[model samples]
Target: MTNHTILEPLREDQWFIQSQELRSFLAKVSEISAHTVDDRTQTLARLEPYFQELLVQQEWLPQKFAQVNPESRMGGGIGQWLLYRAKNQSLSIFSLVIPPGSTTPVHDHLAWGLIGLYKGNQEETVYRRVDNGDAQGHAQLQITEVRRLKTGDIYRLLPPDGDIHAVKTTSQSASVSIHILGNDTGCIWRHQFMPESHSVKSFRSGYSNAPCEEEEEKEHALH
Candidate 1:
């Protein structure tokens, strides 16, 4: 467990700083971010091998980093445990846990993202929007790559440096990943593609654990 004294500076978000292991990971992120900021190539080059190693060697996160109850039907469907977020929305770090047979919609992040698979198996498919509409419109898509990621695997999606894809949890056990995105991912609206309609719409992919007015009201009622 991490010393409680170290968590005071990062109290705005939900995090299990008690885990010394997770704290070490966060420390590594901070160190890498300082040198790699705004440079996708640098970020990938420096962080890629680091996360790749983490996927292979590290195991275990605090209980709080997981679903409240492991067998509780995965209450929120997909679990995204927010750890730390920058005030300027420049970056956001969180853990995403997907239950077996579940998948995120085909979506694109306007900003860059780095995904590290911490546990279980993941299958992701990357797509490119191909539209005959004017020079600016994207109407259809072409599958670029289908990656099979196992625990200890890492990949980046830097609009210009990489591709966009949706992830599916193929393991019987839940799959967990650590996501570091360029901006406030939950607050910003991004594009979600509909292959069947050959269309795309702007939507926000909010995490399940984000605080909101509705949740506050429920808490106030109970109080």
Candidate 2:
């Protein structure tokens, strides 16, 4: 039961475009994170309000990044679009788009994060790992909570706590959520679980718009 796959850091910070809203939010996050390096809980607590503010401003996120990917890695037309990423790979922000009636695989983000509903509604089923994770590809998950999220609703992801979860778009339209995480979530090899089978597998849900490595950066437009 490995925690996550290790990967090299990006050579430089990547910003999809020059958006003042996102730039300011990133600045605030960096400031708060730098001061709260020793405590992840404090970091999330202090940043929630800022994250909330960002989520409510619907215009901040471009429509292009909010669209579902036909060739999605997460399948079922789920789109994970990267908005910004740090050079060190310690932080990232992205938008997750899940089409109507689609559910994400039960997954765990190794790093702490804040996720907020931006558009449409969703049903989130949160799980907890009861086993020690000593057996490879094996895991025992217990459902801890299930939530219905509306626009502006937010949740925290602090590992071993509110970490493992699956989200389904309950609304008629596709649901879009903003994710601010402590790691390169989409690029890193994280765990995706199958609760019915009590199994786990390593997967990398790469961004629909951005490539993982620096060499491929040229393929996408930069502004």
Candidate 3:
């Protein structure tokens, strides 16, 4: 079996800093998500407008969270920084920074979420998995769409349909996108695909700012 780490929910909501804009957005998301908890489609639909509003507001995100990480967990100078996570672990907000000319591995987010370009530009290549998933460590994916997204562009991840994809920064500077997900995205094990090799593997791209349980344990041991 693939080794996976399960993280317990935090005792209280965690915020990197106190920002009124983020607080207001989180409140709206919580309110909308509570009622439509059973239906992910409706939840994402309801959350889109609020997410769009957050994306359009430029000054809310601090520069530190938007900067690229040299030791990126996702590689290619892709930094995933956590800004906020609900106490129950049902909601999370983060910024993904991709340096210019860098591309993320084709990956899947196994939860419903919204990804919006906060700065710069990106080329997103969305894919569809074709195999039945019976074979181990193997997956076949076909490109469904290639989208060029500029600042303020938004997209949705509704799984089994528009889930698997790769993104590359196509601008002079790094591209920063905001992700509001239903799960603790970077901490949980997900799939990363190798299209040319027709292979897949379990991957956990931990946040640059927030360490996972295993990472925390290692840090304690080293001290």
State which candidate, 1 or 2, has the greater lDDT.
2
Q: Between 1 and 3, whose lDDT is larger?
A: 3
Estimated TM-score per prediction?
0.76, 0.94, 0.95
lDDT of 2 by residue, 47-153 (tens): 99998888878788889888999899899999999999998899989999999999999998888889999999999999999999888989999998999999999
Q: lDDT for each of the candidates?
A: 0.67, 0.90, 0.90
> How well does candidate 2 score on lDDT at residue 176?
99
Q: Highest TM-score: which candidate?
A: 3
Q: Which stretches of candidate 2 lie over 4 Å from their true place?
A: 1-4, 214-223
Q: Which parts of model 1 have CA positions greater than 4 angstroms off?
A: 1-16, 56-60, 68-76, 132-138, 212-223
TM-score of 1: 0.76
Q: What would the per-residue lDDT of candidate 3 be over residues 72-106, giving only the tens digit for each residue?
A: 97999899999998777778899999999999999
Candidate with the larger lDDT of 2 and 3: 2
Return the TM-score for candidate 3, rounded to 2 decimals. 0.95
Q: Which ten-residue region of model 3 has the weakest summed lDDT?
A: 1-10
